[model samples]
Target: MTFRECQRCGTCCEKGGPALHEADLGLLEHIPMSDVVCLRRGEMAFDPRTQSLQPLSAELMKIRGKDRGWECIYFLSQAKTCSIYSHRPLECRSLFCADTAAVLEAMAVPTLSRQDMVPQESALWDCITDHENNFPVGQALRLAKAETDFAGSICSELDDLIRREIHFRQVLADRVQAADRDLWAYLGRPLWLVLLPLNPIFSRYEHA
Candidate 1:
């Protein structure tokens, strides 16, 4: 078997950082939301490999990679080093883009969950899961991203989606003070971030 040795060329880092999977959840206690983002199912991203819109199957907590245009937030471009090299995620440790077999195999494993949690953390986790399931933003988001022919339906879905977000925020805020921000994190990136990609579709509908 052959393996690729990294040349410290920084090409991989520029491609972006590894996602935060089940094994990486513990790092959240130390990593701030500014550096990491949770991607909900609603965000429609183009998948180059699939040549289609890549819809998420589950909630994905990923590192914010575009701070420097698709570069990892922890990437020190000038020095060609990762700022948080010592504490990188497991996916990062297993990855070697030149020989992607390991990373591909790792992805087949189920996402990790907290085996043991204290009462407070457990409560929050439960609420997050419940809200995510109950709200079902995927359909609304998909409709909102559709072509102009679905303008009326898109409008309706967007309204419903926003209302659901507001209601969920209320539920979270009731559980703890200042949880509105946490709501965004739990839903993945900021609401505006999700909206950015769909803005063009929205504009076309409005004008038409």
Candidate 2:
């Protein structure tokens, strides 16, 4: 199946649940935190139990106990669409059904595998790798040079850059959180438990 062949039944959209990334927060600047609602509390922050990070809140928690697992406030069942579609989140944009997956993979964009990613810690490594590779080399060099002569102005810009970088880091963290959960389920084992026993064996093999 391919993307072109997709019937756009929106089945995946209806059944599919994708969380937001840090970079996606920029889109929420116009949206007040008061109006936004969190779907899953666990989805909004780093879950130590699952070792995953949650998405950001568009609006602060208004109704008590309203924000908990799976269902999102932004999801509108009537329209059969996300209320915040433009700013929806990396997970939402990247999610695909079988047909979409085949199309994306053919285009050379990496597609998620149920085996590769878990719902909790989805695509974190890829996010980190992308951020690392996407850093602006020219801008960094210019900032470094400008700091020496125009410390005050450059400092302000540097602060903004730092914030942006931090946002990107958050995106990576979110991905890790999702992937970690997925991996745990996939391996059918806790990460620590599996790695502790396997590390030494793999190390020995590497040396050989």
Candidate 3:
């Protein structure tokens, strides 16, 4: 299997399934943050939604599931293409098909097996590392990562810590939005509030 072998079936591209990454955020410069969808603290949502974000409690919220999670608002269904293809995020570009996997393995760098690919964690890490590199949506990534890692029991005690931080940041964002009557004002601030308290742990990853 190889990249050239891809049929461009678009089976993997439809329905807003893939999570956004830091590089995706960078590629999405032209798209307003309001237009992109994201999962925050295990909840699915887009900007301007009237209700709380949807909790991803079931497998249906996954890419392998029927609904395939949230779709990108800019994705064009008719052409089976991304409306913002050129500027699409890194995660989108990084996604490999069966052919791509075979090619990579043939070249000697065995990609992780499918069972090892935790889409949520990978997306969360991409967001965090990229946000730290100065992307605007990193705050959301921080919240998402905290929620994801906490839920996985990787460090169970950190679950409450992360949740508390997420709640605090959400409250702060709400206040900022109320005062400024704008959502962008709250974007970067959440990361600041959440990361400040975890400076000891985060500092280790700063150089990573």
TM-score of each: 0.66, 0.29, 0.35
Q: Sorted by TM-score, highest first, which candidate order results?
A: 1, 3, 2
Flag regions of model 1 displaced more than 4 Å.
1-4, 42-53, 66-70, 113-123, 126-135, 146-157, 163-184, 201-208
- Residues 1-208 of candidate 3 have per-residue lDDT tens digits of 4555456567656534444432233443475544432222322333212334443331111112122234545556677776667775444565556534432333232222211222545643444334334433344345535654442332444434444444544554475464211222122233323343433344332222
lDDT of each: 0.61, 0.38, 0.39
Whichever of 1 and 2 has more TM-score, that candidate is 1
Over the stretch 49-151, how does candidate 1's per-residue lDDT look in tens digits? 4658777666566666763245788888889988888788877787776887787666665653222222435776777666666656575565556636653
Task: Give me candidate 1's TM-score against the actual structure.
Answer: 0.66
Error of 2 at 137 (Å): 39
Reference-based lDDT, residue 153, model 3: 36
Model 3 alpha-carbon miss at residue 43, Å = 3.6
**Candidate 2: minimum summed lDDT over ten consecutive residues — where?**
58-67
Q: What TM-score number comes out for model 3? A: 0.35
Winner of 1 and 3 under lDDT: 1
Tens digits of lDDT, candidate 2, 1-208: 4554434455544433343334345544643333332231112333322456544222112211122223444566666666677766555565555434532433233323222222435553444335435443334434544565442343556446544654554454375564322222122112122222212321221211
Please list the residue runs of candidate 2 whose C-alpha ends up more than 4 Å from where it truly belongs after superposition.
1-17, 30-69, 99-208
lDDT value for model 3: 0.39
Report the poorest 10 consecutive residues by lDDT, candidate 1.
111-120
